[model samples]
Target: MNDFFSTTILIATVASGIRLATPFLLASLGEALGQRSGVLNLGVDGVMLMGAFVAYFVVLKTGNPLIGAAAGILLGMVFGLVYAFITVNLHAEQGVSGIGIYLFGLGMSDLLFQKLVGTPLPIMPFPEIHIPLLADIPIIGPMLFTHSLIVYVAFLLVPAFTLLLNSTTYGMNIRAVGENPAAVDSLGVSVTKVRYSAIIIGNGLAGLAGAALAIELGIFQHNLTNSMGFIAIALVYFGAWRPFGVMAGSLIFGMVAAIVLQGKTLGIIPRSASDLAAMAPAVITIFALVLVANRFKQPAALSKPYERGR
Candidate 1:
C-alpha cells in the first residue's frame, strides 16, 4: 500500500486515467450533440464495435493509422445515415430502431471478423506526442502533456463543443429543436435536417472513439469495447448534456479505472477481489447517472419523432 503512494505510481496512474478517458470523451461528446438535436442513439456501442474492427483491419493491411481512423469515421457516418433515415425520416421509435442498429452492428462486425480473419493478430497503435514545454514540467508534464494525439483531441473537443452549443446559430437550432421542435419548425427551421446532421456527426465521433480504442490498444478482439459505448450514453446524462460536464464525468470514470488497475498491479487489490475491483467504474457510472437524472432534466423532445404537423 505504501508503494502505491509513491510518486512514480501516482504519476503513471494519472496519465493512464487521462488516456483511458479518450474514447469515453469522444463518444459522449457525440451523443451530447445528438441528444441536443432531439435524437437518441442507443446503438453507439454497435457503431463503436464496427469502427474498432474496420480500423483494426485497415491498419493491419495498410500500416497507416490515419487511414484506418478515417475508415472508422466513414463507417460510423454510414451507420448514422441509416439511423437517421429510420428515426428522422420514417418516424420509427428511436429506442427500438437504435436497438436494431446495435444488434446489426454487433452481429455483423463479429461475423466479418470470423470469416475474414480467423486468428487475432496484433497491430501498431498510435504513437505518443510529447508537448514541447509542457512535457518538461514537473509531475504535471508526464501526467497530462505526453500522450497519443487522440487524447489531446478528446480534451480539446470539450471547449470546441461548448462554443458550438452555446454561441453558434446551428447550435441554437439544435437546442431549440430538442426543446421544442414545433417552435423551431414554426421559425422555418427544419427539424429533420437538424436531427439528421446531429445524428451523423454523433455516430462519426462514436466511430472515432472505437478507432482510438483499437489503435491505442494495438489489438482487436470480439466485443473489443466491452460495452464502453453504453457507458458513453450514460455519460451523456451524467454531464447534463453539457460538454464540460461530460469531460468531468469521463475523467472521473477514467481515473477510477486507472486507480483500480494501479492497485491491482501494486498488490493493493487482492486477486480474489479483482473482479469486484473491476466493477468500480461501472458502479460509479450508475451512481453518477442517478444523481444527474435527479438534478438535471433531459430535453423535452428526446426520443420523440418530430413531424412538421400532426
Candidate 2:
C-alpha cells in the first residue's frame, strides 16, 4: 500500500490514466456531437472495432501510424454515411439499425482478422512527444505533457468542441435541430443535412478513437476494445452532452482503470481477484450513469427521425 502511494508510482499511474482516457475522450466527443444533432448511434462499439482492425492492419503494412489513423477515420466516415442513410433517410429505427451496424462491424472485423492476419501482430505505435519546457517540470510535466500526439489531440478537443458547439452558426443549428427539428427546417435549414454532417463527424471521431487505442497498445486482437465504444456512449450521458463533462467522465474512468492495472502490477490485487478487478471500470461507469441520468435531460428530438412535413 505504501509503495502504491509513492510519488513515482502515483505519477506513473496518473500519466497512464491520461493515456488510457484518449480513446474515451475522442469517441464520446463525437457521440456528443451526433446527439446534439438529434441522432443516436448505438453502434459505436462496432465502429470502433472496425477502426481498430483497419488501423492495425494499415500500420502493419505501412509502418506509419499516421496513415493507419487516416484509414481508420475514413472507414468510420463510410460507416457513418451508411448509418445516416438508414436512420436519417430511410427512417429506420435508430436503435435497431445501430445494433445491426454493430453486429456487422463485430463479425466483419473478426472475420477479416482470421482471413488476413491469422494471428495477432505487434505494430509500431505513435511515439511520445514531450513538450519543450513543460515536459521538463518534475511531476506535472511528465504526467501532463509527455504523451503520444493522439493523447494531446484528444484533450485539446475538449476545448475545441466546447467552442464549436457554443459559438458557431452550425453549432447553433445543431442545437436547434436536436431540440426542434421542425422549427429549424421551417426556417430553411435542412434537418437531414445537419444530421448527416453530425453523424459523419461523430463516426469519424469514433474511428480515430479506435485507431488511437490500437496504436497506443501497439497490438490488436479480437475484441481489442472490449466494449469500450459502449462505455464511450454512456459517457455521453454521464457528461450531459457536453464536451468538458465528457472529459471529466473519461478521466474518471481512465484513472480508475489505471489504478486497477497498477494494483495488479504491484501484486496488491491478488491473482484470484484479477477478473473482479478488471470489472472495476465498468462498475464505475454504471454508477456514474445512474447518478447523472436524472440530472441531465437529453435532446428532445434524440432517436426520433425527422420528416419535414410530419
Candidate 3:
C-alpha cells in the first residue's frame, strides 16, 4: 500500500509539472518556428509581455477570453511585422534591433498597464476540457487529456510544426531562405517575403503563448512573463532548432520549475534551494547551446546585413 501510494504521488507530481510547463512549451515552439526560418528573434520577451497585458485587459473589459486571445495574436502580428520590416527588409542587425524591440515592449507594456489598470487587474481563467472518452481512463487519461485547450494546442504543435518543416513547399522556402537567402533570391523566391512571413507567424504564435499565460493563470501583473521570453529563446538553441526538440526541452524546463516550487511548498526541499533549482533550466540551456553550437551550422545570412547593389 505504501509503495502504491508513493507511485501515485510521483505520477501526480509529474502531471503537475507538465501543466506548469505548458506556457513555455508554447512560447518555445513559436520561437523554434522563427529560428528554423533563419530569423533569430530575441524580442520574444517583449512580444510576450505585450500579449499578457493585452489579453488581461481585453478579458477584463469584454468578459471574453477568446477575444482577448485574438487581440493578443493580432498585436503580436503587428509587432512581428515591425521586427521583419527592420531586420529582414532593411537588413538591420537582428540582435541589436531585437534588443531595441525588447526595451520598447518592456516600457510600453508597463506604462500601458499602469495607465489603464493601475497596480494589477483580475483575469478570467480558461475552462479545462476533458475528452469524453479519454477523460474516463484510469491514470493516464486524467494526466494527459484533461487540460485547457491551450495545453492540447501546445502538444499538437509538436507534430504539426514537424510536419510543416519537413513535408511542405513553404517549409522548403523557409529552409532555403534561412540556409542561403542569396541563393533563394537568385531563384526569385523573394528572400525578404519568406523571412517576413516566418517572423510574423512566429511572433503571432508567441502572442497566443502570452495570452495563454495570462488567461490560464487568472491574473495580471507587470512583467508577468518573468523572463520567460529569454528562457524560450534559450530553448530554441537548446532544442537544436527542432520543433519536437523544443517541446521536449520546454517540458523539461516547465517540469523543473513546477517541481522546485512544489517541493518548496511541501517542505520536501529547502526553500532556499528552490531558487537555485529554478535556475536549472537556464543553466542546462547554456550547456545545451554550447553543444549545439559545436555541432550545428547556423544560417548563412543570419544576423548579417543585406544590401542590394554596389
Candidate 4:
C-alpha cells in the first residue's frame, strides 16, 4: 500500500499504462472509422497477429523499427483488401466472414513464425524518444513524454481521427453512408467506395497496432496479441464509437492492466488469483460497454451489405 503511493511507483505505473494502451488506441481508432462507414471488422485481432509477426520479422532481419512499422501497415492493407472483397464486393455476411479472416490470420501467422524463426527470439525493441524539455519535468515528463515514437503517434491520431470523422467532407460521407447509404448514394457519393476505404483504414490501423505491440515487447511468439484485438473491438462499443471516447476507454483499460501487472510483481496480488487479476481490464471494459450501450447509437447500416438497387 505504501509503495503504491510512492512517487516513483505512481509514475512507473502511469507510464506503463500509457505504453500498453498504444495498440488498443490505434486499433480502436481504425475500428471506429469502419463502423462509422457502416462496416464492422471482427477480424482485427487476426489482422493484428499477422502484423505482429511481420513487424517482428522485419525488425529481426533489417534492424529498423520504422521499416517494420511500415511493413506492418502494408500487410494490414493487404488483409484489408481481402476483407473488403469478401464483405464489400461479395456481399457476404459480415460477421461470419470476419470470423473466417480471424482464423486464417491466426493459423497463418503461427505457421509462418514456426517455419521461419523456429524459436521465439527477442530482438532490440523500439528506442524511447524522449521529448527534450518536457521529459525533464519532475513527474509529468516521464509519465507523458518518455515513451517510444509509436505512443505519441497513437495519441496524435486520436485528434486527427476526430477531425477526419467530424470536420471533414470525407468524414461526412462516412457518417451519411452508415446512416443511410441509399441517401448518400442518391447524393452522388459512392457507398462501396466509402465502406471499402473505411475497412481498409481500420484493418491497416490494426496492423500498425500489432507492430507497435511487438516492437515494444521486443519479441514474437504464438498468439502475441493475446486477444488485444478483441479488446479493441469492445473498446469501440465502450467509447460509443467516438474517438475521444475510445481513447478514454483505452486509457482506463491500460491503467488497470498496468496496475494488475505491478500488483503481481509487488506481491500485492496473490499468484493464485492471477487469472482473475488478468480479467480486470476485460471485466471493466464490459461494464463500461453496458453503461454506454444505453447512451449511444450504432451506425444504422453496420454489418449490412449494400447493393445498387437494394
Per residue, candidate 2 scores C-alpha lDDT tens digits across 131-231 of 99999999899889989999999999999999999999999999999999999999999999999999999999999998999998999888888888888
- Tens digits of lDDT, candidate 4, 119-146: 8888778899899999999999999999
TM-score of 1: 0.98
Candidate 1: segments with Cα more than 4 A from true spot: none
Q: Residues 181-259, candidate 1: write the lDDT tens digits.
A: 9999999999989999999999999999999999889988899999888899999999999999899899999999999
Worst lDDT run of 10 residues, candidate 3, spans 1-10
Q: Estimate each model's TM-score.
A: 0.98, 0.97, 0.92, 0.98
Best lDDT among the predictions, by candidate number:
2
lDDT of 4 at 243: 94
lDDT: which is higher, 1 or 4? 1
Q: Kindly report which residue pairs in candidate 2 clash with one another.
A: none
Q: Which residue pairs clash within candidate 4?
A: none
Residue 208's lDDT within candidate 4 is 98
